[model samples]
Target: MIEVLYFAWVRERIGVPRERIETEAATVMDLINELKLREERYAWAFDDLTSLRVAVDQELSGFDAALAGVREIAFFPPMTGG
Candidate 1:
């Protein structure tokens, strides 16, 4: 099982802050595909990959990142600094 965390607008859209999922996905995108199949809320939350950022086990990562040993994944909008 992996802990998936949704932040900012993602949390609002998905209607949850976090969840534990049992998946056999190999990559983040694979996991996302599984989620999108589950419900419209998840589909909307992950609609645009370009508008979102991901982290694996608290470290920033790409969608192609392997989920082999990852225990947590976080989704949020891209951060901007002034």
Candidate 2:
């Protein structure tokens, strides 16, 4: 199981801050697709991949990144610098 965390509008849309998911996905993109299939909320939250940022095991990564041995995956809007 991988811990999936949602932030900001993503959390609001998904109606949860985090969850543990059991997936057969080989990569982050695959995982996102699986979630998108689960519900409309997940579909909306992940609709625009370019507007989102992802982290695996607390380190920034791309959608194509491998999920092997990963414990956590976080999704959030892009951060702005003041």
Error of 2 at 4 (Å): 0.2
- TM-scores, all candidates, are 0.98, 0.98
Q: In candidate 1, what are the lDDT values of residues 15-72, reduced to their tens digit?
A: 9999999999999999999999999999999999999999999999999999998999
Candidate lDDT (C-alpha), each: 0.98, 0.98
In model 1, pairs of residues that clash are none
lDDT of 2 by residue, 1-82 (tens): 9999999999999999999999999999999999999999999999999999999999999999999999999999999999
